[model samples]
Target: MVENLTEEILEMLGNESRRRILNLLSKKPCYVSEISYSLKMAPKVVLDHLDKLEKLGIVSSYEEGRRRYYSINRNLRVEISITPHRFIASTVSETPELEIDEFIKNMENLLKTPAGSLREIYKALQEFEEVERQFSEILGAVSLKFNEMFERFLTEIEKEVEDELERLVLLGITKGADTPFKISEEYGISYMGVIKALKSLENRNIVEKLENEDVWRIKC
Candidate 1:
């Protein structure tokens, strides 16, 4: 099994040249000189990008005498998780262990089944559709839980801080608007209002101000 290379893929694909190289390889495999001439980029740059792709297992290479060919396996799936509080990029496995043989068997009846049995065929189609509906329901339930957790976190913060400004400021921190200016801009509160709230929380040891930067965080 290949190791997880999500991070490497993200980093490697960030380069314009690497993206171009992958675009070229998607059409067909090529050697070093072939890529250089096709992309009009230097041979060294092509080699460097290919080297990184090889290490990440995103590109495979094989030698034909002195010439080496590079090709992309296209064995990748990207999954992005987005919520109000966080965003995550993950690489899902290229291959899934889905046991759909039973579903296929059920569909196989349509082969010999007469076209006059349209209603029967429709019923069989509904069975496959139910699978999609079940998956959608599960995903919807999981997404609701993310919001629920955030609301629960806010409930605890509300218990800790009675002032509305302080509560908003703390919530803003968790949302990554740690600086006073950012919090003010994000929540549409006045800049001075954010500063006053920060000072109040700081004096009460509810928040701490970091030196060198105008950043603040909820006191642990």
Candidate 2:
């Protein structure tokens, strides 16, 4: 829905004649005869088109001195998206104070939305920031809890594993060195030393060597 014929109606701009007539009215309010003449459309056709547009409530008419003038009524925006798996159409009425938060905001900040001169990106970022700021204490508590738990878990693992080399190899794998060669490079251990440590871990059921892959992972 458009509140202003002067403002852009976007995806709702239906046909060529309506577009031309609207394009004319956007510059200034126009009577029906002036619109028909300017657009080179017949007066009856113009009347029919205006009637439909008026019913949509985006165009409104007022009378003055034997002439009725028409202008855009309101501001509205519509968006449509199409893909092989999805089709979505959405409308947004003018909202000077709309707000948003949650997971969608974070994902949009990471991927979907790009910043430009548009107010949408800027407003979205501000809303996201405000949400994060409000939850800062909760976020800090979660981070600290994870750090404390991981440190305690590592300490227990260290007590269970006797050989220092086995411990180092386990730590390397846990940190993303899934292959023997990567473990050797990351821990600065000799390749044979890394292999020997891996064999000991496998025998103790502490880790497993993957079938058909030169990678390793914790047994569980």
lDDT of each: 0.81, 0.78
TM-score of each: 0.48, 0.43
Task: Give the worst 10-residue stretch by lDDT in candidate 2.
Answer: 1-10
Clash count of each predicted structure:
0, 6
Off by more than 4 A, model 1: 1-4, 100-220
**Residue 113 error for model 1, in Å?**
17
lDDT of 1 at 179: 96
- What digit string (tens of lDDT, one per residue) describes model 1 on residues 32-142? 999999999999989998998887778999888898999996688755557776566678656655566565555556443446688967865676577657866887688
Model 2 CA lDDT for position 4: 43
All models, RMSD in angstroms:
10.9, 18.6
Off by over 4 Å in 2: 1-128, 135-140
